[model samples]
Target: MFTTKIIAVILCCLLVSSNGLQPSTCSNQGDGNYGCFDIASQGSCTEVSNQPASRDIRWPHSGIDSNIDWAIKCGDIIAYKIQWFSGGWSGWYVPGVNDMDTKVNNGNGLRRMWSYFYDHTHSYIICKTNDSNKLRGCQ
Candidate 1:
């Protein structure tokens, strides 16, 4: 029984460490409270706003999900996009003070982040790509 218990505890520890667990910090930014999902892992990345008003949080992965309330102020035409290993790009999402969240999936979570510039016609173009940053296994 002692050996079994020891093995179980070791396995639990390994699982926790391998899952890329981390702490998150939240604060009020710009118009409302916002944060960055900072992820340093094998195949995931994000563009985190490291400002005094912004906060930091661990990016979600398989079986783990996250919801974000983008309190976008007027005249700010910025949005976030994500790309997966197999699903490709997920286009820009203008949360615009709405609640946006990512779904849990088997893929290596989100792999990329993109900034968009919205035009008068309600269309947007890729304005920036955080290509210089790469996660653990992301190319």
Candidate 2:
């Protein structure tokens, strides 16, 4: 059993390396910067319906079992998070309210990110990681 576990770990490590799956750490992250789930920094967005920079409104995926290879991990919540990788790992966020409001924060929330960034729909621009950093759309 121990041997099998060791082999599994080795294989996993090998796969991670061969598959470009980076092994990042928050150590390099500067001080005072929020960690993966910095719920405190989630201040507010001047406007929720902010326009999208990346024209591809169908990219920068979310949820598990998705096109994980091409997608970069952005922010994460409890059950899941948005994918927005950057070589290894640029870092992560805790994600804030869907919309800056005391009432329309749920499904009513705008499918945009902080400011006018572009986060697909899962969260918002706080987690944009599309190809070539396309922020204009199918232009």
Candidate 3:
């Protein structure tokens, strides 16, 4: 009876572990690179390459739309279409702009920072790649 009980307990543990109990998120490449879904289909690579390199500024804002909000919470990679400082070529979206900006602004600060920009930038979207947390399912 004792042996049977032990076996049963072991089986239960295995079952629990196999069900992906921990919070896991999927990746874009399937190798678990990014937390947000793959936006490759939406031309992420092209968009990133075409963006002009510029000095990006970090600004904090709140109450961003849902699409941007989701990415900030769970995205792995950041991409952006940066506009140059000069006139014209003013609006475009960047994938990881918020993440990058946040990192730069914080700069080893002790305070915990929450991403707040979602509306100030135009056409910016967050790609939801798979993460170990499994929060988002296959898209």
Report model 2's TM-score to 2 decimal places: 0.17
What ranges in model 3 sit over 4 Å off? Answer: 1-73, 82-119, 130-133, 136-139
Instruction: Write down the TM-score for model 3.
Output: 0.22
- Candidate 3 lDDT, 15-80, residue by residue in tens: 988774333565455444546554444422112233232222222432223243343344422344
Candidate 1 vs candidate 2: the lDDT winner is: 1
Error of 3 at 94 (Å): 7.4
Q: Give the runs in model 1 whose Cα sits over 4 Å from its true position.
A: 1-77, 97-99, 102-139
Prediction RMSDs, each to the true structure: 19.2, 17.1, 13.1
Candidate 2 runs further than 4 Å off: 1-52, 58-115, 119-139
TM-score of each model, in listed order: 0.21, 0.17, 0.22
Q: Is candidate 2 or candidate 3 better by lDDT?
A: 3
In order of lDDT, best first, we have 3, 1, 2
Clashes of each: 2, 13, 23
lDDT of 2 by residue, 1-139 (tens): 9999999999999988777322364333565443455355343232122233443423322222223212332322212223333313212333343322233334454332221123422232333334444434311
Error of 2 at 121 (Å): 17
Winner on TM-score (2 vs 3): 3
Q: Alpha carbon lDDT of residue 18, candidate 3?
A: 76
